[model samples]
Target chain A: MDARSLSIDGLPVPFDDGQTIMDASLAAGIFIPHLCHHPQFTPQGSCKLCTVRANGRYVSACTMPASEGMEVESNTPELNDKRRTMLQMLFVEGNHFCPSCEKSGDCLLQALAYELEMLGPHFPQFYPDRPVDASHPDVLLDFNRCILCELCVRASRDVDGKSVFALSGRGIGKHLIVNAESGRLADTDFSLADKAAHVCPVGVIIAKRRGFAVPIGQRRFDGEPISRRVDWLARRRADDEEEQ
Target chain B: MSNSEPSVRPATRRCLATTSLAGCFGCHMALLDIDERLFELIERVDIDRSPLTDIKRCGRCDIGLVEGGICNAENVHVLREFRRQCKLLVAVGACAINGGLPAQRNHLDLGQCLQEVYLTGPGIVHGQVPDDPELPLPLDKVHPVHEVVRVDYFIPGCPPSGDALWKFITDLLDGRTPRLGHPLLHFD
Candidate 1:
């Protein structure tokens, strides 16, 4: 693993041969905020939260490969402001009731909104009608909280090999759907052990009976900002696996 | 809510007004949550036209902290009235900023919702939709305060913590604009 070096926000960052810019910067403890790029899954640069400037052009850091001598500018005032607006847009696009959400403290969307200092949604709320699916015995699927990140889709297809989740529609109409023809999670082979069950960044995929097991103020992201360390998802998986 | 750079004003004892519209009044509770610090705040500012004073009408105010979303004609009237009287208006909670939980009804048909609740629901012998003339007409959808008027600050939490409100109000009274820090800057 020869560590190839590049500069992010004028600081030197190193990467492996095939590592994307996000992998390199985050591995070096430089935070480029992202929602869709899970370390375990293939990079889907759909969220655009990790957009950074290489030389002079804007590129998604999670998908763009790191090249030596690349001058990457990730955290500028302009970029952060745009990120805040994007966070705002995500809020209004979905019905995110943070107070009532069981996933409030640990949610990446909520945490990122906090890290970005998002004041309000900054636009009129979409308030689309989304159905909650409690069809599975151990899992609960509340579609209202989804941000369309597709981390669950990637996890189910690539890691769990069940392909239990898939996204349907186009643009604002785009939404998450179950793999079953009946459009129900109970009809599919989805299980509590599947990675898809654990990958939702919002309150969409909550485990039954595990609500508020770790109380608010003591939960993850409550004590630390998202940029505090790079391995929250990995730590969360490790913790869940340990319990199992 | 404390994103923009705050311009300094003359350090006079600022007059503060507060109101709740289409909200649970939890934010006002959080404001009292400042606990003993309320006394300190009272010393620094003049309170007026709020629930704490029971004043129905607003006068000229230096700052107004608005809690909750706009859900009815009365809420609209109160919001505009506050805006006209207050120099700087702050959207003080999740409902006030983003239409929080009350806005959940936006996706549903309002008439159907009322019918289900009042007319056709269980345990109703001869129920009818209330058509009192004194009642304010409900808006078609819940709207955040900013949609109706210009909001100078946005502090986004279900009910923003007492500490957060204290920090914001103190800063405003001191003629400084504040930026809420992390953890304390929570949305939930």
Candidate 2:
């Protein structure tokens, strides 16, 4: 297999011929924070979080395919500030009650905020009236807590063969919705075992009865700051696995 | 469902073909990431027409694994083709089984969003909208594969966990009916 040489932040790197810029960056030990583009999933490019300067323009590192002589910059104060804005956009768009949620310690969205030094959501909270759906008897749907990452949507639609979950609105006012016929989760053929349930990056889609089962600090992603290699790798792995 | 039923005989090693419509490939990649089983899968099931394979379509296959929701015209056509050729059609991720996250955007008006993105938004290259034949046409709504075509099995996960994927494939190979037991295997 032929490997193409590319430059990221002026550093020369070799990328597999067909690899995406994100893959090349990860393989070369450069971590670009992203919420939606998981390694296991196809690059959606929906979340603008992973936006990086490729050549001269800002392009999503996850979706931009690696090519010969490509110039990439994973980090810069400007990029970091832009990403911080994106993180704030995510926080304000929906409910992200970090203090009360179980995924607080290990949540990627929360960690990204911390890394970018986002003290508070600068934008006014959209605060849509999303109801908590606990009817399934297995998984919980606290729409308020959802980031609308579409991981669940992709999981159900792409991975699980069940197009049960979807993001309903467009632009800044989007929300994840149930199927067409029933409009309620229980009405659809969806069950607790679907990929959509696991795809939620926030506490929005919680397991029905398992909210407090695991202590907050002991959660898989808690305690350890995301800056360390092991934790960083785990976050990267989880980002790739977020679809699950 | 009890696990008391004895295991069944395995079939001849064959190929697995997969396609994804409006979705990310996380679940599919997670399927491959079942590291231990992955080696055995490479040895046993020949992967064809997969995203990794670079082959979009193939002549024949034992299993057709579909990921993503059927959102557009192309998706419907692809789903029908997969239903047509494969012996068993498996909805391998949340999207195929339940319409997943991309379906969330389905609740909004397609025309309005198109207008926002292509006409009035910040990144529009062409300011004036063209009503010519060359312009991309929008679909009415996004639907799941099972709605359009019959699906034989469902693998559930955000991206289905490695253990679940391995079990699903091995069960299919061994002629056992895959059970949609847990929500993690089947909701969101």
Model 1 lDDT per residue over A1-244, tens place: 5667999999998788898998887678888988887777788899898889998899999999999999999889999998888888888888898888899888888888888888777788877899899999999999999989998998888888999888999988999999898899999999998878887878999899988888878777889998885765434545544542
Report the CAPRI category for model 2: incorrect
Model 1: which residue pairs collide?
Answer: B1-B154
TM-score: model 1, chain A: 0.95
| Sliding window of 10 residues with minimal summed lDDT for model 1 chain A | A235-244
Q: Which stretches of candidate 2 lie over 4 Å from their true place?
A: A227-244, B1-188
Candidate 2's displacement at residue A81, Å, is 0.3
lDDT of 2 at A72: 87
What lDDT score is found at residue B28 in candidate 1? 97
Task: For model 1, state the Cα shift of residue A164 in Å.
Answer: 1.5
- Best by the lDDT measure: 1
Give candidate 1's chain B TM-score. 0.92
